[model samples]
Target: MVDAKDLSLAPRLLPISLSVEAGQVVHLIGPNGSGKSTLLELLSGLEVPQSGSVWLQGQPVSGQTRYDLAQVRGYLMQQQRPAFVMVVFEYLNLVLDSVQLATGEIRDKAVADVVSRLAISDKLHRRIDSLSGGEWQRVRLAGVLLQVSKALNPHACLLLLDEPSTGLDVAQQAVIYQEITALAREQEIAIIMANHDLNRTLEHADTVVVLQQGRIVSLGPPKAVLTDRLLSDVFATPLEQVSTANGPVIMRASSS
Candidate 1:
């Protein structure tokens, strides 16, 4: 469980209180510079809040050591550009071994499992510098997931992801979302993912929180919170919420 009370980060995030239980996926959506990333950072203990407090599992985050907090939370930032060169497999191995004290075979198996799951097995031996944007994003995501899976208590872990599907195409995005959903369901990992793709978030998230200018304009189930009024108001643009054969969709409104 993660509880944040009146979290404020000055100009980036306002005082916001949120509670997340295990086995849930909460999607954060908003335009650029809306404090989506700031909130995730506070929850992950990466940044200290100016006025608020965060509690992870039952202890205050301020009191927990960095390593102690890291053992229970995994964070994936939106951008990562490696300065040093390394093969994809080597990089992933480093991440898996960070919090995992397993045997070599067990660690190797864990790395291979996530590599295959993200469909980046082909690039395992490839140099990280050679990977395309999408490829690197997948490898980074795989590393984050592997780190969380190696947590001291997997069932109590939390995953904080920012635009996790930034460079993936449609098919790859689907696979990543599926894996994320499974992690929340099967492993009971509480996940907070910030994404701009409304359609995908609606499909996979259990709850949606829409923020604008560091304020939550709406929060609830995707269908209930993503109305035409809500989307248009927060986005400052015309959007139509339509009921489609597949499900509900938010579409850009045609010019009048």
Candidate 2:
């Protein structure tokens, strides 16, 4: 569980409050410079809020508590560039090495599970620096997922992701979201992800938090919060909600 209460970061982030329960997938949606990244950083303990507080599993998050938080949380930032020319497997092994697992077999199984979920099994032997942008993104995501997997941290209950599907194609994006859903529903890891893709948020998110100029405008189930007027107002564009077999889809309103 994660709780951010009245969080503020000066001009960039305002008093934002949110709580994510175990097994829930919450999406943060807003335009650029809407403070999604700032909120995530505050919750991840990467940055301390000027006002208010963030709590993880009942412990307050601060610079001093970050080390303890890392034991139960995993954060995937917006950008990741491999500096070294290590193979994917080697890089993943390094990540696993940082955590205390019960056995080598457990580490191997964790790696296999995350790599398969992200569809990166084939890239295991490839150089991390040489992989395509999407491949590298998936590799980084796998590393983060492995950190929170039961094999690494059984107490891992929070996963924070900022624009996680950055370089992937549509299908790969779907795969990533599917894995996110599985982590929440199956592993009971509370997930808070900042994303630009609204439709995907509608499909996958149990709750959506809409931000504007550093403050929360709406926070609720996706369908209720992502109404036509709300989407148009938040995005500063004319939009419409259309019904489909899958669910309601938000789209640009027709001029005609």
Among these predictions, the greatest TM-score belongs to 2
Per-residue lDDT for 1-256 in model 1, tens only? Answer: 8899999998999899999999889999999999999999889887888999998788888866667776788889987888899999889767756665455666677777888989999998999999999999999998888877733335347899999999999999998999899889988899999999999877888999999999887889998888888889888999987789998877999888
In Å, residue 173's CA in model 2 sits off its true spot by: 1.2
Q: Pick the candidate with the highest lDDT.
A: 2
- lDDT score of residue 250 within candidate 2: 81
TM-score of each: 0.95, 0.96
Any runs in candidate 1 off by more than 4 Å, and if so which?
Answer: 150-156
Q: Residues 69-166, candidate 2, lDDT per residue (tens digit)?
A: 76788899988786668999988877766665345777778788789878899999998778899999999899889888876778789999999999
C-alpha lDDT values of all predictions: 0.86, 0.88
In order of listing, the candidates' clash counts read: 0, 0
